[model samples]
Target: MNPWLPAAPCAPGTCAAHTGRTRLRPVAAALLLAGCAWVLAGALGAPFLPLFGPTRRERLIRRWSYGAVRAFGVRVRVTGAPVPPAGTPGTLVVANHISWLDIPLVAAVLPGRMLAKREIRQWPVLGPLAARGGTLFVDRDRLRALPATVRALAAAMRGGSRVVVFPEGTTWCGRGPGGRFGPAAFQAAIDADATVLPVRIGYRVTGHGAAAPAERHAPAGAAAFVGDDPLPASLWRVVRAAGLTAELHVLQPVPAGALPDRRALARRAQRAVASESANRSPESVHH
Candidate 1:
C-alpha cells in the first residue's frame, strides 16, 4: 500500500447524513447552478490575477472564494486573527480535510497556491482550474517523488506564496476523529523557514430545530466528502441541506524553526486542530 494514499474509513453511506429539512428541489437546483458558474468565473479569470498588485490580488481571491461558498447557499463564519499578508518568509496554511468546500474556505481568508494530490490535476473541471490557479501537485503514489515535491513547495513559499495543505491525505467525517496529519507538508515549511498556520475547518447546521438539542451546531456530516463519495453527490448534499454554515478557526501561527523536526511540528499543529474540533459547542451564529 502506498503510505501517502492512506485510506479513510468514512464512507458516504455511513457518514454523510443530512438534516430532515432541505430546500425545495427547484431552489437547490438553482443554487447548484449558480455555484458552478461562480467557480467557473473564478477559473476563467485566474490568468488575470497576476496582473494586479499583491494586495488587490488577495482581495480578489477572497471575494471570489466567499462568493463561491455563498452561491452554494452555505454561510461562512471565520474567527481568530486574520492571516498575515504574503511576504518574504510566506506561510504554510494547514487545515483538516472535510469536503471539496475546504479548498475555497481556506482561500477565502488566506489566498495562496494550493498543495494538492497530483490526481486532482486530472479531475474534470476542478483539475484545469487548479492548474490555472498555480496549484502545486504531488505524486503521492511514488515515494521517490516526495523529495522533489517538498523542494517545489519550499521554492513556492520562499518566493512569497502562502501555500495551503491538508496533511491528512484523506477526507473524514467532520463530526468524529479525523485522519492524522502526515509530516511531509511540514518538511516544506522547515526547509523554507516559513510560518505554519493551522486552521480548523468544520461545518454546522443552523436555524430553528435543524438539529437535536445535543447535536445542535455540531459538525454537519452532510458536508463530508470521504471514501468513494462521488463529487456530484457531495455537491448536491450541500446545496439541499438547510442552513449549512462553514466555519474556519484560524489558530496562532508558529515559526518553522520553533520545532526540532517536521514530526514534532506536525503533532503540535494536529493537536491544536483536534482540540478545537472536539470543543465545539452550541454557539450563536453571526451572519
Candidate 2:
C-alpha cells in the first residue's frame, strides 16, 4: 500500500453512504451554490470580467472550483511543491488524464485555462462555462489544426497564462499507463520558453473518519472517465461516494532549455508522471 495514503477506514463506499446522507442537506446546498456560481460566471462574471481584470475572474473561478470539489465530496491533496501561479514567466503544467474530475481538482489548486479536446467545447453547461472561463480548445484529430493550436497555446503562455495540457491525449482508468503524450502540446512551452510542470493524479476513498479495514487497496477507478463512461453516471458515482480524495503529485518542473525539442520534453514529462503513478501502488507501475 502507498504510505502516503495508508489503508484508511474508507474503502470507497463502505459505510460512506451513511455519512453522505447525514450531510446530504449541506452537500446538496453546496452543489446548488456551485451550479449557481458557474451560471453567474458564464453570464455575469466572464462578460464583465475584463472590467475587474483576470485576477478577479481567476479568484472567482478558484472559489467556484473549490466549492464544486467540496460539493462532490472529494478532497484534493497536493504532494511536492506548488507550481508558479498563472502568467508566471514559465508556467505550463502537464498532467496525466484520469477522471473528468481531474480538471476541477487541478483548477482548484492552480487556476488557469486548460487545453481540452474539441468535443468538450460542445458539452452542455461545462463547455460554455469553460469557454467563458478562458479555456482553450483544440481539435486533436485534425492535423492542420495542430499548428494553429500550438501557436494559440504558445501565445497564451507568452501572455503569462498558466496552461494545463494532458499529454496523454486521452483518459485512462488508473489501470495502466495512459496514451502516449503527443509532442505537439509541448511546443507551447517550447515556443514560450517556459518550464513544463508535471503532475500525477490518483484517487482514494474516504472512510468517514473511520478505519476501513475492508479496504482492498486497489487504485480507485470509480472516478475514472474512461472509454464509454457516461458523464452523468460518473458524476453520480463520485458525488454519492464518500471520502473520495484526489492525490496530486506535482513533480519537478522540466525546463524547456533542458530538452532539445518538443518530443523530448513530452517524453520527459510523461516519464515523470508515469513514475509518480507507479509509486502509488507497487503493481500500478508502468511497464
Question: All candidates' TM-scores?
Answer: 0.93, 0.79
Q: Which candidate has the top score in lDDT?
A: 1
lDDT of each: 0.85, 0.69
Give a tens-digit lDDT track for model 2, residues 1-287.
22321122222233212222223655745654564565455545455666766676677677777666666666666666555663466578888877888887788767777998888999877887678778899776666777999899889888888888877776776656666787887888989998788888877654543454233234566677765567765666665555666777767888877899989889898888887443443222111
Best by TM-score: 1
Candidate 1 lDDT at 250 equals 77
Query: Candidate 1's residue-wise lDDT over 38-70, tens digit each?
Result: 988887898898899888878888889889989
Q: What is the lDDT of residue 205 in candidate 1?
A: 81
lDDT, residue 98, model 1: 93
Worst 10 residues of 2 by lDDT: 1-10
Q: What's model 1's overall lDDT?
A: 0.85
**What lDDT does candidate 1 reach at residue 281?**
46
As a whole number from 0 to 100, the lDDT of residue 197 in candidate 1 is 95
Question: Number of backbone collisions per candidate, in order?
Answer: 0, 6
